[model samples]
Target chain A: DAGVTQSPTHLIKTRGQQVTLRCSPKSGHDTVSWYQQALGQGPQFIFQYYEEEERQRGNFPDRFSGHQFPNYSSELNVNALLLGDSALYLCASSLRTGDLMGTEAFFGQGTRLTVV
Target chain B: DQQVKQNSPSLSVQEGRISILNCDYTNSMFDYFLWYKKYPAEGPTFLISISSIKDKNEDGRFTVFLNKSAKHLSLHIVPSQPGDSAVYFCAASVAGKSTFGDGTTLTVKP
Candidate 1:
């Protein structure tokens, strides 16, 4: 079975430009989350989407936004990208249980974004 | 403030030995802890997890131990193999919002 899938394995964007990364969650999954992994560091949570609406967010700024489609796919948009925005954009999917008990997250290969 | 911290940036263990990676957190609200393994040019894969109510959970050769009072968790791999070498990340969550630590790279030598 195809796990979480992301598009445009690698991308290059200039400063101040905007970019959108896409993700299709694994079959039977309802929640999608985005994360940024900088060089030599672990991933930083960007935000999470559930039922076509943003359910939770991390410490990211307004420039970072996301949308969850009815099919449970997701898009992560970063506006006015800076050089620091260059990192690996990871997409993870999971089954959301009401208790927020933290179920296992299945991740995609990730889209590497390079901001010049 | 960085809530989750992996003090050891890297570790090297001989094959067939036990490899233990440690993590600490400062947030009291974090009740769930997970360990993820990442290879180069790939997203992290969930290795194991432990809830606050449980101090230990084992899956085959992999085990996760949680210490709520200490706000710490650890992942142990027995009989480490070369293929087990990778970057390991420790993550803590509260209400499904997770905070990841700077990963620890493990190298298993044959």
Candidate 2:
């Protein structure tokens, strides 16, 4: 079985531009979440998607948005990127049980985003 | 305010020694805690977790201890190996959302 997979291993974007990162969850998983890991810091929760709808969100602003497709894949879009947006974007997949989130998650290698 | 805090930025230990990474959280509602390890250029991999109901959980050389009253948690690696050297992160979850610490870089010297 394949683990979580992300696209465009690395990317470079200019300020004020937009970028979209993609992720395919592990097989038999129904929930996907996105995180941002800045240099020398731990991954920060961006948001989580379940059942094709956003289920939970972190402290991120409105500029950061995400979508979950019917197939359980997800896309994270950041608009008006700033220099601080440069970081490693990680995607994690888990199997949600009832009303509780999965305790353990499988992560992808992540897409390194550089805002120039 | 940062909910989860790993005060130690890095830790060094000799092989076969014990390695302990500490973490504290400001949120009292968090009910679940976990530890994850990451290598360079790779996303963090889940190591172990303990619910609020349990004070300790062990898996092989890795053990996680939670102190709900203090809002603190720790990861212990016994007889550490060189390969175990990596960034260890402490995460806390509540209401389906999880928060992570800055991570502690552990170096096990052989």
Candidate 3:
């Protein structure tokens, strides 16, 4: 009954450095999605992974990429991170029912990434 | 351009009162609408949702009303409690991909 879990609860890095954030989706869930939430703003979608492949992506740049392991775990990689990248990175998991009808999405506590 | 918009940044209500949160969306293709609550340092948690086929859905003290023709939806909380004070986000989705609003912070004062 464990919900989605994210690792490295908080991290600080210099601009241009790379950071890798990890996430383990909730048990019984298969789809994983990443979101970024800046101070005082709502979460913004980044990308989604299903069946070990990226099924949908938002407006994020190429510097942001992710992978979904066979075990349903996920990793978000940001290359040459910019100061603007500093935000709370959230991971959400949901069961993908056929036809894409709305399914309940459970979220993790999120990894706070600070790019100085 | 944000497809979903929550114009109110914050709202305050006396305890035991009714709380209404409004959300508007520009995308007509969106078939589902949801509301999520978030506390500081935590991810947004699902609250309630409504689909295009239905105009209203209720769960306990929380209820959502959708007006498809106006492209607007609202969340109503009756007898608001202190625990309900948090930032609420309105989202619209298609094919499971959601577009979120700017979020509204609600404070239920005792």
Q: Model 3 chain B, poorest ten-residue lDDT window?
A: B91-100
Candidate 1, residues A1-116: lDDT per residue as tens digits?
99999998999999999999999999999999999999888889999999999888999999999999999999999999999999999999999978965888999999999999
**For model 1, what fraction of the real interface contacts is kept?**
0.76
User: What tens-digit string does per-residue lDDT give for candidate 2 at A1-116?
Assistant: 88999999999999999999999999999999999999998899999999999989998999999999999999999999999999999999999998665378889999999999
User: Which whole-number lDDT from 0 to 100 does residue A72 have in model 3?
Assistant: 95
True contacts kept of each: 0.76, 0.71, 0.71
lDDT score at residue B18, model 2, on the 0-100 scale: 99
Off by over 4 Å in 1: none
Q: Model 2: how far is B45 from its true place, Å?
A: 0.2
Question: Least lDDT summed over 10 consecutive residues: which range in candidate 3 chain A?
Answer: A96-105
lDDT of each: 0.93, 0.94, 0.93
Docking class of 3: medium
Instruction: List DockQ for all candidates.
Output: 0.83, 0.78, 0.79
lDDT of 1: 0.93
The best candidate by lDDT is 2
Candidate 3 local lDDT, B1-110, one digit each (tens): 98999999999999999999999999999988999999877788999988899999999999999999999999999999999999999989887788889899999999
